[model samples]
Target: MTFAVAMYNLYDKPISNVKVVKTIPDDFSDPVIRETTEGRGEVEDNKIVWTIDKLIPEETVLMKFTCSIMVTDITKRRTGPIEVTYKANSSFAGGLAIDKYDAYTRNKFYVDTVERDEEPGVWDCKLVFENPSEFILQLFNADVYSPEDESEKFVDIDPKDVSLLPAGAQWHSNKWRYESEELPAFRKKLEFRVMPDFQTNVNGTISISDVILEIASITGGMSYDLTQVPTYKEQDVIAKLKIINNGSAPLNEIAINQQYFTSEFNPPNASEVTMIWDGDEVDLPSNSVKFDSNVFRISLKNLRNSDTGLFMPESILEFEYPIHCVNPVKEATFESEITYLANTFPLSQELEFRPEVPIIEALHLRRKFRIGKEVIPIGALGKYQIILTLENIGTAPLQNVVLMDKVPDNFEYGSYSGGKPQITDEVGEDTLKWTIDLLNADDKVEISYEISGTGEYSPSDAQLGL
Candidate 1:
């Protein structure tokens, strides 16, 4: 393995006669001095040293080296514990002053996987550790980690708290059991300290690989208005479905089967329901469409792998269709079966439709006045005729229709024409109300009444209907 070391001058003034030394372990051989950024030095007594004449403020130097491991036992490997000694020239002292620095590398330990047991939706891991030094290690601890939301882990170690470890000995940790819908990758970290020298610590890591498969379905649609208490009839409704792949491995030869049903009405006929591709009408593909008594099935093939692979975006399939409804059913349901390699049982998804009725928005009322044969001017005292019209321009019919119109204060009530209106007198105004049992779509009603005004008078603005 190759390693790099870097040194920097942090003082404001320049430093002189700087030397850096790195000690090599006995278990390593074939030491090769690959590259150095500044001045160079040679290996002496298994130590690599470099000497520099001067180092300016904020200057840096880097060194690289490569070596081979001579020891076959993992516990016998040791990398580093570097040291540096330097001097600065002081004008007052008239001599070189010595300063020393020390640095330590992370000691090497061994963490290995002993074995693994696997079954559908479950996996168990076994791990082992080795200590290569002559000294005893204390307070040794190990922990395994997995995604919190995706998997559960259980671990067991032979001795709960390992207070002592003999030289060149191996210890086995408790078997780790992982339970999840899909196998998940895990990380293991081992930490320990050598006895009589608690400050000297060692840490090692191990990674485990896993393979998983995930699929999801999402749906959306539009339904007819129900607020108007509309008369039941055949109405067109649209629905869109999307299928996504969210797994690690490549998904191949994917087949999807979708079924739709209604409880209160017959399933939509194949001739009445049509599929659209890219906003254009098209016949359903023969290889993908299948129909039974009330079930409609659609199949898809060769879906690409999800984003967990080399691809950055997930693989997805989407389609839309319009179905006809002739009854006021409680709900319409759509179900799916997705099958792919290694997943023989197939994944399933169910979606129900219970759309809310929309509110009515098309109600209009108008008022007009005529005096015998001429239009009456404002504030004119005369016998004039008032006409009120209410129209239901909405698509659905209305029930229990009531129209209320307030007569101006200066006008006297007269006989009504066209339709009889219930008249009521208030402190300052009179109100005329007309009731209709039912108002069909695009229906209108007109009511006319004669009124005598004592002073200039026009129709009052207060008019309400339901």
Candidate 2:
């Protein structure tokens, strides 16, 4: 087969309004290549032109040129999209020649063309050349594989590991067993691009969406009480992570692998407490995550006084996780704090009742008595009546009483008329005692005593001295 090359200007014309101001080099043989314009041009003039080269031999050839144009609205202060397509006839057979066996030659065929439109937004470009001969056709794009950092391809992360993503496109590998016509053979590479404009949109839309590798959080820390720093009940604290959506697209299924440690806990009710989560892997939400301040909680029992739990005050939590950046998985490490909590009670119970006096009272008493003119002679038998009155003078009632008096030598016992009294006590000192069973908080009791004495003497001479 003979090879003949020809150049065609998509943005150019032979006559007036349309013309190809730019062209690819004639010596260039690559079917898929990138060429930039020296300067921008107005649409009316169509100054910029894309040059096409024909590498196949034939009578007539067809070429497809595609690119996205970005249009700026100076008044609106924003950019839009406009896609451009150019097809022209060439004096050759088929299109550009591509070597199927060469990986480098085939990869150079992928290209993404962009443009701005006045009405809509930017137009994304995907150019497909249908008219194919024996030669292969392809597109050219930037290399997805990084030569400097090989570790950027695969990584392992623990549960507590949290990764902050950079602004750009992010991708993670998914095992797809199915086959497709576009890619007849399986390709292992995952491609991602972080465009600045796309990053700006993500930052504006998301609050704190980022990648997170959550292991577990802690509610209690190292604390001491009267006992041997009683270990708190082991509670599974929700591991929280902070992630920033720095990329153009959201990240999903951020796998966090956590190596959980067996915990020792001292419960207030018992001596030991512990718990475990069944799985080693956890999946994060769809959005790019931000910082999470919540704690993952776990129930524990049989806590001990001398032991510690997986999450405790001042406890250190460390783990790793796989990260998605620029479409590949990388390893990231996360470190956090775990805390513990202790309970307490009062030493004494509350009082219900107390003993106390309700009330008190005081009493004062004075009396005077006189003898009337009715005596016959000294030592004469005579009957007389004595009047007496009583009053309440104390807080309590008095009962079971008896009356007694120390009469003079001329006095004798007379029949007294009133309520009878019962004597309760009599002492050798000639004193009498009375007892009363009924008493109130502030009530009083009263009693009286009476006696009579007589002597045969005139008023001037009191009774004979005795």
Residues 319-426, model 2: lDDT tens digits = 222211111111211122333322111111111111121111112212222212222233333433333323334433444333332223344434434434443323
- How do the predictions measure up, each by TM-score? 0.26, 0.18
TM-score, prediction 1: 0.26
lDDT of 1 at 145: 60
What clash count goes with each model? 4, 81
* Count of backbone collisions in candidate 2: 81
Tens digit of lDDT per residue, candidate 1, span 1-466? Answer: 4556677877666776777777777756777788888878677878778777777889888788777764332232345566676665433443434365333323343333333454566655556666667766653566656646323444333345654776777666666555556545566667776654222112212221221213222223233333222124445454454444343323333333434445422333445445443344556446565567565556434334422222112445444554444444332322322222212123322222222223221122222222122123334446666666667776546667766666666768667766777766532347777777777767776777776766665544222221
Instruction: Give residue 49's error in model 1 in angstroms.
Output: 55
